[model samples]
Target chain A: MSTRRLIPGSAELRAEFPILAREVHKRPLIYLDNAATSQKPAPVIAKLVECYERWNANVHRGVHKLSEEATEHYEGARAKIARHIGASDPAEIVFTRGATEAINLVAQTFGRTRLAAGDEVLITALEHHSNIVPWQMICRERGAVLKVVPITDAGDLVAGAFESLLTPRTRLAAFTWVSNALGTVNPVVEMTALARARGITTLVDACQAVPHFALNVRSLDADFLVFSGHKVYGPNGSGVLHGKRALLESLPPWQGGGDMIASVTFEESTWNHVPHKFEAGTPDYPATVALATALDWLSALGWDAVAAHEHTLLAAAEEALGAIQGVRLIGTPAHRSGVLSFTLDGVHPHDLGTVLDRMGVAIRAGHHCAQPVMDRLGVPATARASFSVFNTLEDVAALAAAVRETKRLFGA
Target chain B: MNDLDDLYQEMILGHARQPRNFGALAPCDRSAKGHNPLCGDRVTVYLRMDGERVREIQFDGAGCAICTASASLMTDGVKGLARPAIERVFQDVHELATGKSDGSKDLGKLAVFSGVSAFPMRVKCATLPWHTLLAALDSTSAPVTTE
Candidate 1:
């Protein structure tokens, strides 16, 4: 089962990312840090340059030619995001800095407006710090409690615990579709449906999921779905926050600035509609346009091919690394995606990461901004090797060899 | 293996595996916690000073190999050094790790960190314990942070 299989277009995909061709520490770079941020493809990079070179102007308010082109591309990107996520209306997709800001927008606006004293915001232990901290901030401000659903030792969410945690006071529920640190793919569709049945608002952090698989927000029935562009082969500081039209109309605006106001007199200002109300100021138009190109690029590749390719990498890494003496893989969730974290018995993750780096293999070695998960797992940190479209079997071999070297260094 | 060996010398690994003076000191005169928030490495330096000399120096914490090894070597190196000498050692280690100066003969076992100069990122890991020792000596309660 661990035998390597060729992924069609895999070579072409690898060639598209220029960074992969370079060497680190005099060794060819074997990038296993995709969960942190994916290396951008050639088309995505070109799209960014095209947006700046061809249509560089402030969006929404200019009558000039460049402005019109910029506004056209900006709104066009929003439409592309809406279509990609299966949202019927483009007006529902709000642009933000990234997934963090998108989650913060919902927490501050929807959360602050709807939640009251004694209310609870339910989250999962698998959530990234972005998903966890925003709810904590909003809950604290609204005099609401923040509750967490527990996960098993295998990093799977405890299904029974989730139902018990959901109460009449659970005003909202937010969770990651795919855990960044642990590779656990949460039961997002079922969890969203459960929350919907109880009339609790739901938000899904698809930062990790969007890169590995195709997503349709409508089928998931989440009130809000967010993912960063950088994670999905797009430019940095660009993301989509897909909210239900009715829910967005109900919530108050997050930021007050030029583009978000319909009319501003000296005293009172009328807020703009849904997306514009949330997206204040002149946005990063180049990044927005480049994000659309990234979606198109992935759509061209198709999910079947992408998913199959990533699975092979994950499976091979699991088999190769598990065979190493004294190496303990962190999570074996029944369903997982994108990441593989592990600990070597005698070598600290930092040492492993440093050694791996010397061998031209890059991996994350820390809590991965999810301290709660670390606290639960009883480890300070784990060395993580995350897969992406560009990763191949050679990369996995390099990773396995590096782990063996690390073990040898520690005399295991 | 050229520069990497320098950073993780056999001596450094030995010190990390069996850190010297690794435990809390009871009724310690001066103690300060050190934190490297980026990697969640924490160390608490305890000093029992005898007038101008460090009578006892010990550390208790969890950290990466570089940090643990540095702390172990630091405690073992500075146990009998006076304040002025400890200050000089700190400067020498700093210079050695940053490649600003050659390994002074005085650095001794601590010279094992001279390879750390090649890996700029790990310099903090080797110096955090030393700074925490300074904080303890200064009698400050604020945790020393190596950002």
Candidate 2:
């Protein structure tokens, strides 16, 4: 794997991320927490500043020039996001606070309206809390049952589980495209096809997937998909919910406010169009424009190059970190990406995290918001070091050394 | 790594490895569970009260080194004290862990955790046990959470 050939501009690209040069605790920072949130590049940050400095105004209401410019940039962002994911129409993209809000919108509107008593909402054990909890709330409220498709010990979905789970009573199937905790890439396209065959509406939580590869929602055939901006090296409070045009049009408005209405009376109100009906209040226009900048920057890198770079780092991390004594790798999926989760002998993940932090090697040490996954793995928690395009072989070496130091400190 | 050394002294690590009064107290009078949802660290403090004084105290659950060591030191620190005296010690320990005051005056063996003040995010780990103990004393049914 010649990373230089895979990404010829890798050095220049790495320089674009300013925070990579920062030092934490008097040592140069080795930021391996990309799964939680990715560091923003210079273009994305500059776009945010430009939005605030040049055209900072509410969209769709005012006829002033600033509002018009803001609206163009905001709507332009929607089109860019839709095209990035290969959605058929820009109207399918709904701006959200983040993936959590995006999932909740579908649950509150579509799930609330469509589900009936005795119906089942199928999710997988690999889902983040954002993907699981909304469905749980909707299921409990509608007297619907929540079904979980279990994963194998290696963290992959059990073979034939999706086909078997999709029965007549299963109203919708929601699952993650990648496991944030274990970095296990689910067979989402196949799963979605199975659900569609059984007339089940499918939603893919692509928060972890979008950063690592290109996704085509049309080819995927999932009725809905979601991702957060911050996880994609974009600004926080920016997210996207991509739905099939007809499916989004069929759903009722999730929230009621000024921009979402067509005609309002004290007695009754008529709603706006598909995407606008879902976006109730003033959207985060600046963040949305910056998110578009992030997508453009990422797309310019070419998904193949990004994937190749990250894959190399992830493989190096696995080998280096695994070589240390008593360091147990948690997930060994056939198609893993970007994340390496592990636990050390006689040392808790939190303790490992603290020692690593002292050495400026930042990693996540928790259940990773997948408590059921933690329960299935039969561990309290695991330390996770997720990668990005900016990470290098040296970062992996730093992580390995930090783990060794942590072991020595604990006398493991 | 001065701060790291301060945070994980040999005493703290030893207590974490072999907790003094671990496991549930059978025939216990009062008990409460403490949870730090941030890291999924959990502990249940159990007390066998002899009228106004604590006759025996034990705790059982899984947590990080700081949490387990803090619980171990806490049980050992408050075993013989009466309810009022235990509450006073809790206040002092809380102040010491938060870096409001040094424990040189009265914290005794519990002063091993004075190093925790340097790591603000870990204050909850060192104090979750004390909170559960307070909850047990108050006979609260809800599990104490260090958010």
Candidate 3:
């Protein structure tokens, strides 16, 4: 099926984007590296422009109209995001630079309060370095132990590994909802459910999942969910952290700065309420506004339509890529989103990427910030083409075409 | 600039597949590991020095074509050269490849990599072996590692 009109569904609107409307390398830009970052739609760009042009005031302190407007828009964006992720109250959401910082915030703050010297932190084999490193940093500082839950040969987190790793000393479990490297849609719901049953707090890095699928925090039963806005067609510096209010309230404010504290004195200072306590300095107000607009754009596209279109593209990609000799797909789970990571014989991924770039096709080729995932999959690096709402079956053909070209060039 | 021929010049690919003096020297003297985390390029260079001269040079690892081919050329060029002369070879390679050494150096097979410096990202892949050469010379019995 010709999916050019289906994926982004922006036939009526995408022309408004000055960037996408132009030609790249004399060809229509087919952006398949959505996992690296998705291009912002026109509405998000407009929202960014609106924030800078009209409501250009620092939030939370002023009584004047512009300040009030700025604060309202800022907090309103939070509410929109809260609603987007099935959060009951805006207080449950905190703004972060991106999911990496959000994850670090939890690891540093919550890990400090809940974990002891001997406590163990559980993370899966497929987590991004962002998810893995912060906890390692906190553990190294606090003398707590870090335990990795291994994955199966097929790249699923070995279900039993977590059970054995979960001791009474286990403090928290954090892992990705869907792996960025292997495109493995982890059974995080079942895994998180199990973690919670063992009295271990669970954190899910939903950066890859939330942008592609509908998310209900209650259904996932995760204590904390983190995702970046940029991956969801929003601004780069904005991200969301959805936590249970009780869990959020119990942790100390992560970064000491303005907005996070209600009052400060030389003698003693008390913290602000739940969300703001974590939102330290002046937030990325423009990016946050743009994030809400991106959400609105996605919602208007509708999940059922987006999922249907993506499934078509992904299936075609799998079949076409499988037909090529020496092409190995990383995650082969029955359930997956549209992210595909593969390796071709006798061609370095960077060489493959450079050849594809020459043809005006873009794909991510590297360790994908998941070296451990690369290690698990027994590949040095991979070339990945991730689909967003804007991608089409044509993008799949583009990927296959690029691989064929790469094979020809590499004498494979 | 010279057609993508600058990238896959026959010499570059030929050396990449059949790297000279590759594998390990028997009962090695000094060796080091060079790692490129960006592309996961790794190589262990083996050197056996007869007094101040490098009598034998060898390498074994997995890396991109540029790294492997450059390394292969490097071992061939440095054999029988004194430590100071080998150091001169390092400078000459850097000059020819990085556009620093007056551009008149007849690098033979190494000039195939000069186009790599133009790409910027591949410069390290081309220079990794030479960088490991310095580290291997100093780091005692344990292999010196460079990134």
Candidate 4:
């Protein structure tokens, strides 16, 4: 196959990810499972080391120099993350374990306090289990009903469904900007606007969108937005929850611990501030700083370039894989990003995943924690190959080849 | 890293393609369902025990190649065996699939599952049928899950 230059400085950009050079099963590794989690770039890895080597101390409490420096870098990371998502104030950004925790934090604090019996929480069918289960728990506890917006057969959200679900009883509307299972990019801006106009709060799960889109919380007008660090080429245990300052201040603290307290007595303890009160315990300072480094590295590459490169790869994969007989692409949304889910006619996804592993092509093959989407598509699971900025046309070709080999092996 | 052929032997693939006893057993005396939530594999084992002697056994489910084949082979291997003999064969097959015991001990036609030991992640897929069968024999009401 001839090498195609899709992204400028493509080779250099690939070189920045050291793991891309390694071999699996004596063949070159084609890591296509970006939706599961991304491979960390060299600078992001180095930032973790730099944080541990230079400023190894707990943040925010101690008067020592190390603590002060650690606190500065930690807070600096919050500010960078805020800016990356176009938030005006750093105080609005609260660090959580990952997108799962971020959503749960909002559900426990906001959903628990604001929602009353007979109130409704609206969600789409495209949500991952993390987004679904937390609201279910909170809704069950508060006697609130959980309303689901269905999707069309093409994996797009059913047209006009969001507006219909926004009744007076609907207190919150949480949805994903991009579907991880099918790569369906929802109309988050319009949906958020619709909910906002009806005086209902909105939460956007941008875990799959942050790497591919230049998000602006101010323009999107979501009351809360969240994304995971590991999914965006950063360390695990780091994530951001950006809520409007007034909205966050209105909700009470979910968890009580050492750092979130302003003052303590035998009878009473005052909360510290907006973000800190939500943070609760000691934060993962190094991982937070490294997450900021990842954002900086991605920003230097430019979001438009990254989106273009990934789109090229996804389109190439769709064309190549779709041409093969018995290879059924799961979602045909008008707009998609990064993820491509498919299933072969005779072979199950688990068997296909095992065969692809032998060929050194890593793809996610399962329900993808979105069983409802699988049920909607009328399949038990699918083999999903998600793309990233470092992925190339060559990788798409490799995926197609591996899939063909799988079909041959299975006599399908 | 064993070759794919080691796992997907012709016999296993054949059974997976067209599973034997692959439907609900009518007027079954005992039955149990097995589920592997991680991969969404589900199997139901039905048994018609005739006074603890030779009897009929069958299974039906939706599973992967390994799981479907394993269940198919299990029904064929365990049918007509007494309670004691079925228990012994179950131990042997479990040991063979987990690599605790080599195929040197005769597992009859069940020895085809020996290849499953190499793929540690797939062991559950290979053994879901056996677990369900055991649950059916014990008449356990709760469904067996390989979590």
Give Cα-based local distance difference scores for all models.
0.89, 0.92, 0.83, 0.91
Cα lDDT tens digits, model 3, A196-309, are 888889999999997888898878889999999999989999998899999999888889999989899999888999899988789999899899888877876778888887
Error of 1 at A159 (Å): 2.4
* Candidate 3 segments exceeding 4 Å error: A1-18, A22-27, B1-3, B82-88, B95-102, B140-147
Q: Model 2: what TM-score?
A: 0.98
What would you estimate as the lDDT of candidate 3? 0.83
The digit string of per-residue lDDT tens for model 1 on A1-412 reads: 1124324337856777888889898889998998999898888899898988899999998899999999999999999989988899999999999999999999988888899999999999998999999898988899999999998999999868877888999999998999999999988899999999999999999999998888898899999999999999899999999999999999889989989999999999999987899889999989989999888877777689999988998999999999998999998899989999999998889889999999999999989989899889989889999998888898899899999998887786
For model 2, residues A1-412, the per-residue Cα lDDT tens digits are 1133224126777778899788999999889999999999898999999999999999999999999999999999999888899986999999999999999999999899999999999999999999999999999999999999999999999999878888899999999999999999999999999999888999999999999999999899999999999999999999999998899999999999989999999999999998999999999999999998888888777788888888889889899988999999998999998799999999999999999999999999999999999999988999999999888888899999999999999899
Error of 1 at A53 (Å): 1.1
Which pairs clash (backbone N, Cα, C closer than 3 Å) in model 4?
none
Which numbered prediction scores highest in lDDT against the true structure? 2
Q: List iRMS (one decimal) for every candidate.
A: 0.9, 0.5, 2.2, 1.6
TM-score of chain B of each: 0.95, 0.95, 0.89, 0.93
Q: Which TM-score does chain B of candidate 4 obtain? A: 0.93
The full ranking of all candidates by TM-score, starting with the best, is 2, 4, 1, 3
Candidate 1 to truth, TM: 0.96
* Candidate maximizing TM-score: 2
Q: Write the per-residue lDDT of candidate 4 for residues A1-412, one digit (tens) a residue.
A: 0133235238877888899999988999999999999999898999999999999899998999999999999999999999999999999999999999999999999998999999999999999999999999999999999999999999999999999989999999999999999999999999999998999999999999998878899999999999999999999999999999999999999899989999999999999888999988789999999999988888777678887778888889999999999999999999999899999999999999989988999999889999999999999889999998888888899999989998888898
Give the Å shift of residue A336 in candidate 1.
0.9
Count backbone overlaps in model 1: 0
- For TM-score, candidate 2 versus 3, the one ahead is 2
Per-residue alpha-carbon lDDT of candidate 4 for residues B4-35, written as tens digits (9 for 90 to 100): 88889889999999999889989899999999
Per-residue error at B25 for model 3, in Å? 3.6
CAPRI-style quality class for the chain A–B interface of candidate 4: medium
